[model samples]
Target: MLSKRIISCLDVRNGKLAKSVKFVDTIDIGDPVVQAKKYYEEGLDELVFYDITASSDKRDIMLDVVSSVAEQVFIPFSVGGGLRTVEDCSRVLLAGAEKINVNSAAVRRPELIREAADAFGSQAVVLSMDVLRVEPRPGLENGYEIVIEGGRRRMGIDAIEWAKRGEELGAGELVINSIDADGTKEGYELTLTRMISEAVSIPIIASGGGGTPEHLYDVLTEGKADAALVASMLHYDEYSIDEIKDYLIGRGLKIRKA
Candidate 1:
């Protein structure tokens, strides 16, 4: 079995690292470059840098920050936000991001996924989906809807269907973030994560609502996620990468030991 990966997420807004509860009530955490270096030193499997407000604000990603963080961290790093075209992906890659994550852009123009895969290879393309459970309307086939623009815009797209489509479009991985549970620490939305995981062949990185070491294990074991992405808990010093990895390993989950 492949060892489950524990990834640290840095949500960069206006060049600063920030965290929020349910995607609101934002609070500045620290500097992205410094934090990225710290996580790399602490032996994190991978680091995810997201320009959280770029899509909503309709601005490009912070290339300077990206370049700095990329220089500091030797592990794989994935960057996202405000990437609208192949050129945008090229710029991010040139900025030293090993992988480029696309959410709104891919949803708005799915062909961009193919374009990126063709230009940069599928392994360099990550499809990020911000999903929320909406009230079941009478005619809706799926219970969940995909929201874009930093979860500010509701597109009425089904989450499971979108994951399958992204995989078909040559997306190397799927980032399933549950907006309803984000930063709540209640645990991951296991049902929704399992749906997407089962629907897609590519690896799925489950994000949002990871409040404790047990929460991380729950998603990786019970939720059947290939990897787990966490922010708030780690940012606030609630847990360390080694601590979480130890806890998961103790619980019989296969994890990479640093």
Candidate 2:
């Protein structure tokens, strides 16, 4: 089996690292560059940097921060937030990110996904979906709906359908971030994770609610995720990348070691 990846996430607000629970009550943590460097030294497989407020705030991502983190981390770096057009994607790539994650903009104009994929290749494009669990309804399927702009707006699009569409539109990978489970750290939304992972052909990175190494194990196995994005567990010094990898390795999961 291919080695499962442990990814560290840096959610930036005004160039500062921040964390939120259920997509609300965000608090500034620390300098993202510092965290990025620390994670790189500790052996993280990949890093995802998101300018969390850029979309709703209607502004550009802090390229300076992106450059700073890029310089500090040698692993695969994925960036999202405030990327609207193919030109914007280019600017981010030129700034140093190995992958560009498109969320709100892509939902607003899915053609942007194809355009970005064509311009930078599908491997360079990642479609990030901010999803929430809602009551089952006629227009929505599986009780999972698409929420955007920091989970402030409900797009009314079905999560699974969107994931499939994103893959068909040429996204090389998908970051399925569960808003309800985000920062709770109890566990990943395994039912939702498994559903989307099975629906798509590309790799799925399970995000939100990862509090322990066991959570990572569950997501990669039962959830069928290719990678797990961790924030709160690592952000609060609750766990280290090496420690988590060791746990997964002991649990019989093939994990990339530091």
Number of the top lDDT candidate: 2
- Model 1 vs. true fold: TM: 0.94
Candidate 1 ranges with C-alpha deviation above 4 Å? 53-61
**Top candidate when judged by TM-score against the true structure:** 2
Full-model lDDT for every candidate: 0.87, 0.90
Give the Å shift of residue 39 in candidate 2. 0.1
TM-score for each model: 0.94, 0.95
Q: How far is candidate 2 from the true structure (C-alpha RMSD, Å)?
A: 1.7
lDDT (Cα, tens digit) per residue for candidate 1, span 224-253? 899999887789888888899999999998
Candidate 2, superposed: residue stretches over 4 Å from native: 53-61
| Superposition error at 114 for model 2 (Å) | 0.5
